[model samples]
Target: MARLTALAGGLAVALVLLAAPAMAHNHPSGITDLVTPAVVRVEATAHVDITLLDHIGELVHVERSYDVPIGSGTGIVINPEGGIVTLTRVVKTDRDVAVYAANRVFAEHHKVKIPADFARHKLKDDVLNHHLQECYPPKTPTATCIINVTTNITVFPNVSPADPKGLKADLVKAGDTLDSPAVLTLSGRVLGSLGMPTAPLADKVPDAAGSPTNVAGFLGRPAPNLPFTVDIAHLRQGGGGDSQGRQFADPEKKVDEPVKLGKLIDEGFLGAPVIGDKDGHVVGMLFGGGQDGRMIGVREITAALAKAGVAPRRGAIDSAFEAALTRYHTKYYTEAASGFQRVLELYPGNVVAAGLLKISLQKRGTAEDAGTKGAVSPTPRSLPLWPFIVAAAVLLVAALVGAFLLWRRRAPEERVEEPPAPVATASPQQPFDEGANPTVVVRRSQPFQVVPRQQPLMTANEQPSVKYCTECGMRLGPAHRFCGYCGHPIET
Candidate 1:
């Protein structure tokens, strides 16, 4: 059953946000404050001013009138424009007896015989019935023959009779006469109204643990089961006066339920708001039926408002807060956080929003850090990274250059002079004989390019030229001491 108790709204937020161990017991959130302004203790005073009439239904001289308190009843404002819902009897002054009283006085004023009516009326004057009728006609009737007509209804709101906020409500459509839901509206009216909750409470199955399982997946996020329970209670009093019939309770529902109102509400508290405990939403209204009372659900209240041609709408803060609360239950921590922040912006210092926001932030932080304990922390925004990166790059380039220069510095310094070109040992004075034998031409055995060894102060072309080995037909390298391939002793 949706029978929930009324709690402070802040407490409800805390209950949803706090951990299980930290919140050992349910705390008061004072959520009713949200509904307090909407809820009103209605003290209605109905007055009737009587005048006499003649036998022909013509008005006669005025008779003694009455201006007295009829009764009190509570009512819910369905619209910020003054649309309210209450018992039909509260707003409707059943002056049927007053009608009879006026007629009796008319009979006596005309000096006509009194019919067999249950009540008698005092005579207005000694005028005869027909004479008074002749003297006072419809519009042309004399002032003395005017019909008795006067009724005043005054509604006192949250304040008592002494409070200045007393508002006079007008009867738009009396349920007693229309057989529809009873409704009312105050003079000053209400500035805002609570929007009805559209979603029904789906029956939840509990997991192996006793808590309900959150089977609904909320946009790829883990849905947390709402750990809060609905609180229910009724405001009741015992006294005398015309009592407004209370709303009917669920016939099959058992009494003693926290939400089921078993006691009779005195007439004064009839229309007072029946606030929910946890969310402070109106679970139902305290309506008078008989000895038992029932709260009107959001659906019924909505319907009644519709019938009255008034739409039940939500204010800015209430709308955002409710949306956030819904997201919180589904464990949409990020979205809920944004929603709560929006509400806070709209209504600063909103306790419910603040508490819920803290919860949302905490949950979001935990979700983000779930497995990132060893991960790197984010860099501070105050420092720019580009400068540091550039510095590192410069250091790397300098290190490479330093290594290259150090190798050059460690290179050999002493140069061995080539020994005097080994004497060709007169390739045998045979050369002199060969010269006479034929015009012989000397050519290089191995093709070679001239290579030069240069000091730091010299250029490649300015270095000393290398000579080839005269004995083994091989090219020489810088400072070579022997022929590497031929195993011959090098001259230089």
Candidate 2:
């Protein structure tokens, strides 16, 4: 049993040693990649349809329709059910699209001079001026034009092959301010089943100034050619929970932070999520643009989501991606590759996982990979002594255990117990004749006793007995030649 136990222990150690090389290469990249997959591009437009009434020279009716671009920016998916958070300005515009459509229609049909813009303009002619004035706002009993407007929102996810048509979403809730957070829900039923990757929202903004963070979002339509971008920045002091929002700056001042982030916002980072460097959770969102760029803290973001009645949560796809990401950052490229592949199976078109998978495959067996180190051919100088020493020690322990078990098994057989010898007793016989020699009965344990032939013998029916010492009267055995107690001699 002990030998079996030792062998089992040695086997376990050997297995662990063999597995060490495979696990040695793991190094984790910080939390940046965790939020990238959930970022998406948001585009909104106001579709306007207008009909103009021309009655001055002739009774003529003209109709026109136009799609005016509202705004475009970035947003983060906050739940598996396709809930999203972005700036209100992305989906809800402040400008009057109806007025812009009315201006263009009047200019084209009436041949009237007017700036085709969102601003209301008066005409030189009295009748046309009166008509245009009526079309400016607040529909009343004396209206001259008919207009209708609808807002259309589309979300392009960071995925492979690119979602060309994009997912349709409706504004669930909008914040009080334009730069504040607005919530949207994807329209289709399939979005809930897709297990979309989601960004985790931090409970509140970091209190300390100069907290590190990453701002990740798409610079263009999500595609292989235009992958999402991530930029590092630090939070500046002040504007913790105010409409003014927070500022970003470089502690080292090596780079002009406001200028740099301004360029990013102008390029397409508007409404991007600001991820906290400490834990990789979203601390705020990139708001505003140009030299006046700022961030909206998580406290306001959650308030908007709460108004929308959508709970922010993670899903299974996140589980798989995080597992793969850990292996990837640890430099376990071979194992990392397999893990990423599993993530893609769970959530296809995952841009982050696909990118990491490609890199993992490339680096799996390279010299930098720790997993491949032990498998490489070794030279005399490159060979290590620890492995050999460990093997020798393991063999020595096994031998000792086996020897002990063998000794224990054979101990009982080697110890032999002798049976008690048969006790000898004297039988009645004719006494020795005529004093030739008096036969003496002796025992090993006692003195001998002698009887003369001239003396009378006992009858045949008498009970037989052993001898005793003549002087000491002590009991004796048949082998005794002298009394044990008295030292008396006896003839044999």
Best by lDDT: 2
Model 2, 324-433: lDDT tens per residue? 88777766688889999998888888888998999999989886454576546433223454675577577767777787788899877665333332233335463422
C-alpha TM-score for every candidate: 0.39, 0.70
Cα RMSDs, all models: 20.5, 11.8
Q: To one decimal, what is the Cα RMSD in angstroms of model 2 from the true structure? A: 11.8
Q: TM-score of predicted model 2?
A: 0.70
Candidate 1 lDDT over residue span 1-492, tens digit each: 011112233344444443332212232332543454344445545354545433436433446554444445555554445566665555555544453444545555544565524343333454443444433324244433334444444543332112344556666655534223566655554322432111111112111211111111011101123111123443222212223322332233444422333333442444445554444545444455345554434445555666767655446555676777666655557777999898667645454467678888887645432222432432232233445445555555565566667667754333333333322322331221212111112223545444332322324455544556677565554344554334457653
lDDT of 1 at 63: 64
What is the lDDT of every predicted structure here?
0.44, 0.78
Q: What ranges in model 2 sit over 4 Å off?
A: 1-29, 189-193, 238-240, 372-492
